[model samples]
Target: QVCPGVTPPTGAVKVTPGHSPQDLALARAHGLPLLSVIADDGTLRPPGGGWLQ
Candidate 1:
């Protein structure tokens, strides 16, 4: 599906496997890797780092 106000040939949805259940299911169906970016304390972990916090 195309997003409103988005031009043709450039429409895409970003899947956040760690955050959304739907995205996680999509990722799993597509054999995509699941990455953890948030820690138990709600802090950003490695790879994401403090820059994103």
Candidate 2:
């Protein structure tokens, strides 16, 4: 997953531990946001809170 302000290289794909489709689907079904990193204040990073209701 990409950091809040970090730039990833071209064609870069952040593969975290639970990036599988099954895991994603499961998290989606449960209304949970999938996250790889968080802010220093404990806030979920981008692409993470989107799944939250």
Point out where model 2 deviates above 4 Å.
Answer: 1-18, 38-53
**Which 10 successive residues of model 1 have the least lDDT summed?**
2-11
| Each model's lDDT | 0.83, 0.61
Leading candidate by lDDT? 1
Question: TM-scores for all candidates?
Answer: 0.66, 0.33
Candidate 2's residue-wise lDDT over 1-53, tens digit each?
A: 44565555355444443658866766778677566756678777666655652
Q: Which pairs of residues clash in candidate 2, taking residues 3 or more apart in a chain or in different chains?
A: none
Model 1: pairs clashing at backbone N, Cα or C within 3 Å: none
> Cα deviation of 31 in candidate 2 (Å)?
0.3
RMSD in Å for candidate 1, one decimal? 2.0
User: What tens-digit string does per-residue lDDT give for candidate 1 at 1-53?
Assistant: 66777766585679998788999999999999887877899788977876775
All models, RMSD in angstroms: 2.0, 12.2
